[model samples]
Target: MVAKAVVKPAVELPVRADEDSWTEAELAEVRATLEAEMAALVAEIAHAESTIAEDGGGDGAGDDQADAGAKTYEREHEMALAHNARDLLVQCERAVRRMDAGTYGVCESCTRPIGKARLQAFPRATMCVACKQREERR
Candidate 1:
């Protein structure tokens, strides 16, 4: 019988000794990226609210049936987007908290420094790439 190979867990990287492990420049970049994303999400929510408001401006007017249907669809779509954005905002807030706690780059699952590239792509990631992949599998 053939034996299945065991997958080893990824190794953790050493934490930097300096108080501010990440360079000030890097922290600034991350802050800017997060702020921009937050602004965009808020704008999207405003736009959705405006659209719904416009659809419901009239007071018991003609074509109420069509207006009701359109308003319902818009509300559902807007609500979904709002919920997703709210969740992402929560994640972003947690990442910012980690930065303040001096554990921003360290992966929550393995205590490893998530590489610069990964941090740039996913600033809110709490797990390293390997751990994240493993989580997705389950």
Candidate 2:
């Protein structure tokens, strides 16, 4: 007698479809999108860090006064931009973590499933459209 080998399907994050449990396919699609976003954000953060380090000059030595001022300004600007990138990266990581925890589709504010269209555009979003708008108005 030949033994039959069974292949189990991969487990994926749960996504809500029309207020119902998401099929494995839907979850897989959303998971792929979120994972891609997380990877891109991490790469962007790394690039920003390296660029900031290259532009940063700790001491004012071997530079003219005007050049030093320009370097200082540029460093500060670069640091601010890098900080924003880091913040976005954090959000992306959080979203990925939520996916792993089986809570990826819900809004953090109202505990509702985030809209599908919104998720498509912003994979790292933590709030639903209503909550986001309310927060913005405050």
**Candidate that would win on TM-score:** 2
Model 2 lDDT tens row, 102-133: 67768889987786567767878888899999
- Per-residue lDDT, model 1, residue 97, is 66
List candidate 1 segments past 4 Å from native.
1-21, 50-70
Q: Give the range where candidate 2 is weakest over 10 consecutive residues by summed lDDT.
A: 5-14
Q: What is the C-alpha lDDT profile of model 1 across 35-136, one tens digit per residue? A: 788778778777767766776576655657887787677778877887787788778877766666566778888887776567778888888799899989
Off by over 4 Å in 2: 1-21, 62-65
lDDT (C-alpha) at residue 11 in model 1 = 22
How much lDDT does each candidate structure score? Answer: 0.70, 0.72
TM-score, candidate 2, is 0.72
